[model samples]
Target: MTDLERFKNILNEHREELEKEYSISNMGLFGSYVRDDQEKGSDLDILVEFSQPISLLRFVSLKRRLSQLLDVEVDLVMKKALKPRVGERILAEVVYI
Candidate 1:
């Protein structure tokens, strides 16, 4: 499978796990993987929107879990906490799942 397809599968798996364990409202894929510009070491950039505020510890733990599952680094962004420009950029590029 292509990298995007692989990443989408990984994202779907993670999304299921997250939904089972957390109160997330939305989830999406962005950045290099979504753009089809990822290099060998490009990390997965995921935007997660939670129904309520989540703790740093939880976020870190989630990132760790995703990284381990995908065998690549994960950059998790809280959708509600993004700056205006960054949010705009993410919105422009994100492929929701």
Candidate 2:
């Protein structure tokens, strides 16, 4: 399978646990991975919407856990934290998980 498919499967495999643990309302994959142009050592970009705001500690924990799960470095962004123009572009390309 392609790397994208592998990533998606990994995320989906842990989706329920991640959502409950992190209070996530929605989650998606974005950036280089979504565009299918990730190079060696590329970071995984993920966007998330939480059911409620999470503490910075919890956010960091989530990011770490994701990186461990996928065996790739993760760049996690919250939906509520995005800037307008950039948010639009990211949302347009995001593949919802």
Candidate 3:
């Protein structure tokens, strides 16, 4: 399978654990990986939705956990924090897992 497929599978497999630990209600993959245009250093772009407010520390922990799980750098973003225009484009192509 492709790296992207592996990443999606890994995340789906750990979805329950991550949701319980991070209060994440939903997650989606976007950016270069989604477009199949990623370079060697491209980080996985994940748009995450939390079920409740979480501290910055917890957010960072989530990012780190995902990076470890996928064995790739993770650029996590809060779905609620997205700007209108950018969000539209991202949401357009995002693949939720």
Candidate 4:
């Protein structure tokens, strides 16, 4: 399989674990992997929103879970919801799951 195909397959294999570990209610694949061809060793870019706040410890824990499942480097950029939008961490970048 191609890189993108393998990447997607890896994601499919870990969906349940992702949701359970991260408490991610809204998870999606957006950006290069979804639109453009992924080069070898390219990152799996995803966007995820948890129902509750995600602490640093939780982030690290989730990353470990993904790593075991994929056996490939996984980068998780978790975004916690903050109200008013005055000062919120930009969620523009993609996060791999």
Q: Backbone collision count in every prediction?
A: 0, 0, 0, 1
Model 3, position 48: C-alpha lDDT score: 96
Which 10 consecutive positions of candidate 4 have the poorest summed lDDT?
81-90
Local distance difference test scores for all models: 0.83, 0.94, 0.95, 0.61
What TM-score do all the candidates reach, one by one?
0.89, 0.97, 0.98, 0.59
Model 3 clashing residue pairs (backbone): none
lDDT of 4: 0.61
Rate residue 69 of model 1 by lDDT. 76
Clashes of 1: 0
- Between the candidate structures 3 and 4, which one is better when assessed by lDDT? 3
Considering TM-score, which of the candidate structures 1 and 3 is the better prediction for this target?
A: 3
Model 3, C-alpha of 85: deviation from truth (Å) = 0.6
**Which numbered prediction scores highest in lDDT against the true structure?**
3
lDDT (Cα, 0-100) at 40 in candidate 3: 99
Report the C-alpha displacement of residue 69, candidate 4, in angstroms. 2.0
Candidate 3: tens digits of C-alpha lDDT, residues 14-84: 99999999999999999999999999999999999999999999999999999999999999999999999
CA lDDT for candidate 3: 0.95
| Tens digits of lDDT, candidate 1, 1-97 | 9777887787686776687676778888899988888898889898888877778888888889878877889998988789998789999999887
Tell me the lDDT of model 4 at 92: 46
Name the best candidate (by TM-score): 3
**How many clashing residue pairs are found in candidate 3?**
0
Off by over 4 Å in 3: none
